[model samples]
Target: MIEMINIGLPDAIAYRIEGKITEKEMKTVLAIFRKKIKKNEKLIIYQEVVSIGGVEFNAMIEKWKFFLAFGLSHFSRIAVVTHKKWIHKLVDLEGKLFKSIEMRGFSKEEKDQAIEFLS
Candidate 1:
């Protein structure tokens, strides 16, 4: 399941993710991103990952399509808070690949730090 988080920012949004992510949920998130883009909002994302069972294949396709269509310029920063060390490492690698967006991973304990980084 995916739950939106309110971090009190107009251009920025946050979400908590747990369990498997479905195609329906992915579409919902894409809709939100499209709305932000249409509004000309420079976006920042903060994701708190409690647990991830997996992502549906269709959801992955949808995510890739969104990125391809919109590109990454609309995003300014992405902060991922998770307990998994592997996820942090992956985020680090992703940061290297996606140079335009500042992506950082924080442990659950450092969620405040993630928000601060976003700010």
Candidate 2:
């Protein structure tokens, strides 16, 4: 499941993700991104991963397709807050792949710092 979090930022959106991610939920997220992109607003994303069960195969594919087609350029920053050590390492590595977007990982305890980084 994924739930939107209102952080009171016009150019930023946040989500709390848990459990398995389905294609339907992935579409919902992509819809929001499409809207933001249409407005010509580069985005800052704050994702608080409470718990990840697994991603549906379709959902993973959909996410990759969307990002490949339209998302990469529209993102300015990404802050991932999670307690998982592997997630932190993965985020750090992926951050290097995108020169235009600044990606950072924060411990769950440093959620405030994550928001500050987005700001």
Candidate 3:
């Protein structure tokens, strides 16, 4: 499941992932995000991972499409908080794709640090 995190910030986008993510949910959220974020606007993205059951094939394709069409450069900062090793590595690898963005992975215990880093 994918749940958007609300920190009550206008320029920040955060999501919590529990189980497998579906394409419909992603498209809905992506639409909302795209509408809220203006072109070339700096955005701070947060992914708080509780547990990832994996992503549906269509969902993965949607993600790729979003990145290809919009690009990750719109996000000036991206922070992910997770205890899972694979998730940590995954974020690190994804971060490499956006060298212009300041991306960091924090343990679940360091979620506060992640938020502060984004701030």
Per-prediction TM-score: 0.94, 0.93, 0.85
lDDT of 1 by residue, 29-115 (tens): 889999989999878999989999999999999999999999989999999999999999999999999899899999999988998
- What's the residue-level lDDT of 99 in candidate 2? 76
Tell me the spans in candidate 3 whose CA falls farther than 4 Å from its real position: none
**lDDT for every model?**
0.92, 0.90, 0.82
Which candidate gets the maximum TM-score versus the true structure? 1
**Between 1 and 2, whose TM-score is larger?**
1
What is the C-alpha lDDT profile of model 3 across 1-119, one tens digit per residue?
Answer: 98987855667888898988999878977876677565656778888889878888999888889888887656788899988888778778877876898888999889888888887
How do these models rank on lDDT, best leading?
A: 1, 2, 3
Instruction: Give per-residue CA lDDT, model 2, range 63-99, as digits (tens).
Output: 9998788858889999999999899999999999887
lDDT of 1 at 70: 96
Q: After superposition, how far is residue 97 of candidate 2 from its true place, in Å?
A: 1.7
Clashing pairs in 1: none
Say which candidate scores most in lDDT: 1
Model 1 vs truth, CA RMSD: 1.1
